[model samples]
Target: MDLEVRHLRVVCAIADAGSITKAAAGLGLSQPSLTAQLRRIERYLGGPLFVRSRQGASPTALGEFVLAKARTVLPSIDAIQVESALRAGAAPDRRPLRYVATPGPLMVGLLEELRELFPGASPALRTETHVPTAVDLIASGQQDLAAVVEYLRPVPVPPPPDVVARTVATEPAFVLLPAGHPFATRPAVGLAEFADAEWVLPPNQACGLFEAFTAACVDAGFTATIRHEAESSAARELVARGTAVGLGQATFRSTPGIVPLPLAGCPLLIRQVLLWHRDGPLAAHAREITEGAERAYAAAVRRSPHYLAWLAERPPPGAEQGWAGAGDAPP
Candidate 1:
C-alpha cells in the first residue's frame, strides 16, 4: 500500500499520546489494530519508528525525522481542507469577510475598502489589544486576516510557522503634549525635553514595548515620572489637562487641547503587518488589503504636518526597502 498522510498521522499520534493504547483510543481503533497499522507504516519507511516499553512510546532517530515532516505537512493539509469546504459552499453574495486587528486607522479604512470590494458579503470585526490573541485567531482559521503590529522592543515576535505576516507599513512613535507646552512649538523634541514632566504612559502591552519607551528616556538623560497608564482617549484627556504627557502613534489625532509632536530622531518604531493563514481561503486577497492599509496610512500622514515633515526629511528605512508601519496605542 502507498504511504499517505493518514499513515503519517498514526506515527504522530502515538508519539503525542505516548502509547499505542492511548493513540488507539483517540483514533477509535482497538489496541491490536493500531499496532498492526503501525507495523505496516514502519515497514513502509524501512525502520522501527518508536521504542516501546512500560514508560510508553518514544520516537527513535528515524521516527524523529519522520515526525518532524508530518508536523509541518498536517497543518497544510488541514488548511487546504478548510479552504476547500468554504469555497465549495460560499456564494458571492453570502461569503463573509472576517477581520480582526489590534487597533489603528488602517482598520477603519480597510473595512470600508473590503465592503466596496465585496459588496454583498457580510463582515465581522474584532479588536484584540493582546497581539497573540489576534495571531491565534488567524492561525486557527477563525479570522481571515489581521492587522497586527510588532513593537520594536528588544523582544522580537517571530512569524508563526503556519501564518504569514506581510509587512503593510512602518510608523514611528510620537510624543503627545498639551497644546501650550513650550516643546510643542519646536519642529521635533528630544526625549530629554520631557525629563522633568509627569507622564501618562501607554498601557503595558503583552509585547512589553513600554520598557523600550523607558529605556529611550534613560538614554536621553532622565527617568520618566509616570503618573498613570491609559489608552488614547484617556491619555489625550490626561495630556490635555496638563497632568501628564504620553506616547502616541502617528495616526493618533490632535484634539483642541492636545497635540502630537514628532520625536527628534524617531527612536521608537513599529512595523505593521497583515497576517493570514497559509493556503486559507482569504489568502488570495492579502495584496488587496495591504493596498487599502497603505491608502489609510497615507491619509493620516497628510493630516499630521509634523509626521509628514519628518518623513520628508528622512523617510523610514522600511519604506524605501519594502514597507513602513505603527505603535500599539489606540489610533
Candidate 2:
C-alpha cells in the first residue's frame, strides 16, 4: 500500500500508544489487523518501526525519523481543516468577537464580562502565551485582539512592530511557596532570599518574561537556579511538594498548602496589555476595548488582597484602577 496521511496517523498512534495492543484498542482495530497493517507499513518504509519488548513497544531509529515528520504534518492539516470549516460556515452579516489570550484562570470571569460588551458576536478565544505566536496571529490577520502580559519592571517587554498595545493594568507578581516553607509566613520576601533556592520558572520562553525574571535575579545580586519549567498546575505541585518554588500572578488563586507572597521592592510587575494590529480591524476600538478589559481586571483585582494592598500604597497605572476613571479615559 502507498504511504498516506492515514498511514502516518497509524504510525503516530502506535508511537503514542507505546504498544501494538494499546494502539489497536485506541484505533478501534483488532490486534492482528493492526499488526498486519503495521507490518505492511514497515515494509513500505524499509525497516521495523517499533521494537517489541516485555515492557512495551519503543520506536527504533527509523521510527523516530518517521514520527517527527508525522507530528509536524498532523497539526498543519488540522489547522487547515478548521480554517476551511469556519470559512465555509461563516455568516456574511455578522462577525464574531475574536480575541487571543494567554493561559490564566483569572480570564474566565474577564471573558464573561467581555462577552456582554460585544453582544451577538460570539468571541472565540485562542490561548497563546508565546510572544511570537500571538504577534504572528495578529500580524497575519488570523486574530486581531489579544489580552497579554508583559514584564514591565527590571526590563520592559516591548511589543513588536506589527502590534500596538495599551496598558490595562500593572499587577505585581507573587511568589508561590509551600505552606510549610520557612518564608511562607513572611509578609514579604526579598528577591535575593531565593538566590540559592531551586525554582520552577514559567514555561514561556522568548517572551522576555523569562529574561526579565533572570535579570531581576541578577540585579538582586545572584542568578536564579531554575530547576524545572512547567504550566501552573505542575508548578503548584512542585511547590506544594517542596520540590521547587515558583512565581505566581498577583491574582493567583488560593491553592491549599500554597502561599503566594509579594516580593519586596516589587521587582516584578506584569502589565496586562490589550494588543491589536496597529492597522487591523480592532484598531478603531483598541482604546475602548482596552478600557473594558481594565474594568474586568479591576473586578479581578478585588479578588486578591495583595492587589488591593498594593493599590493602597502606590498610584494605579493608566489614570485609575476602577471603572470610573481608568475605564472612562483612553490612555
Candidate 3:
C-alpha cells in the first residue's frame, strides 16, 4: 500500500516518544489530527498498531513488524531526497564527522594527524573524562565514534547490538606516583608492592578500566583504596603529586612532577578498544580521519616499543591476549 512521508514520520515519532501527545508535539501536529491519521493508517492495514496503557503506548507485534520495514524504507526515501537535491545543485556539503575521545597526549597527536588528512573538513571532537558517557554518546548516534578503555580481562557492558567495537591498541599500564616515591626508582613494580597505596581512578561508569585497576590490585592480593575517583588525566595528575597511585598505559603523557614506573611482574594489562556504530556508515571524510588516526597510532607505537614487550606477557585468567601491548591504559 502507498503511504505518505507524514504517516511514517508519525509512526516513527510515536515509537520514539511512546506517547501520542508527545509524538504530536514533536511533529507539530494537533493531538486530534495525530489520532485521526493513526486510525486511518490502522484501518488501511486492517489492524491495530499500538497498545495503549497507563504507562504510555508501545508498538503492538504488528507495529514492531511494520517498524522493521519502515526502517529500511525510510533510509531509501531520505537518500532519494538527498539525491534529488544534489541533482538540483542545491544540496549542502556533507556534515563534519563527530567523535568523542578521552583526551591524552596520544589523542592530541591523533587529532593532529586527522586534521592534516582532512584539511578542508571540519571535524568536531568532545573530551569525555568518563568512558560510559562517551559510549552512551556514540551508541545514541550523537557521536559518530568513541574511544573507550578495555581491559585484558573482558567485562560486560550494555550496548545496542549494532554498536561495533574493536581493540585498536593494547599497551601496558604504568603506576604513576610522585617523583620521590619509593617505587619511582624501580624499573618495574607489581601491584603487590603498592597494596596499601591510595589510587585516583576513572569513574566506575567507565567500567572495564576501573575494574581492571581494582582487580589488578586484588590479584596482587589486596584491595585498592580509592582516595579520589577521576578521569585518566586527573588521576595521573594526582599520582604525580604522590597523593595517589594509578594504572596507566605507556600511552600516558608525562605530567609535570609525576614519575611513571612500570607495573612490574603483574600480568600485562592492555587497553581494550575502538568502537563505532555499524548502523551509520562512515562517510569518506570520516573514514579519512579514521585513517589518519591509524597512521598516528602506528607512529606512536613505533616510537614506544614497550607496548610490544608488554604484549608478550602471559594473559591473566579469563583474559584474551589477542591485542597485545605494554600498559593497560586509554588510547
Cα lDDT computed for each candidate against the true fold? 0.73, 0.71, 0.63
Give the best candidate by TM-score: 1
Query: What digit string (tens of lDDT, one per residue) describes model 3 on residues 1-331?
Result: 5677767767777887898989889778898999999999988877888998877779999898877777656544543443344334443253454557875433556667645654443446777767767776655455666666555554545445545565555556777788888777766777787777887877665546656666676778888788897866677668776788776666555467776666766554665355565554333134454566666666765554444444456542232453333222223
Q: lDDT value for candidate 2?
A: 0.71
TM-score of each: 0.68, 0.66, 0.63
lDDT tens readout by residue for model 2, 1-331: 7898778888988887899999999889999999999999999999999999987889999999998887656544533443343445442142355678875532555567556655444657778868667766665445657766666544344556656666666667888999999998888899999989999977874555787688789899998889999877788899999998998777787788888888998787676666666555556555556667767877777877766776787775441221223222245
| Backbone clash count, each prediction separately | 5, 0, 12
**Which residue pairs show collisions in model 2?**
none
Q: Candidate 1 residues 1-331, lDDT tens each?
A: 8999789878888987899999999889999999999999989999999999999999999999998888667656655554454445443332366788887766666777766655544556778787788887776555777887655665555556677777766788888889888887888888888888898976765644676777778889888899898876788899998888888777776588887888877777766777877656566656665777777678876887766767898866453221222222112
C-alpha RMSD of each candidate structure in angstroms: 8.6, 9.7, 7.1
**Stretches of model 2 off by over 4 angstroms after superposition:** 1-95, 153-157, 316-330
Error of 1 at 321 (Å): 13
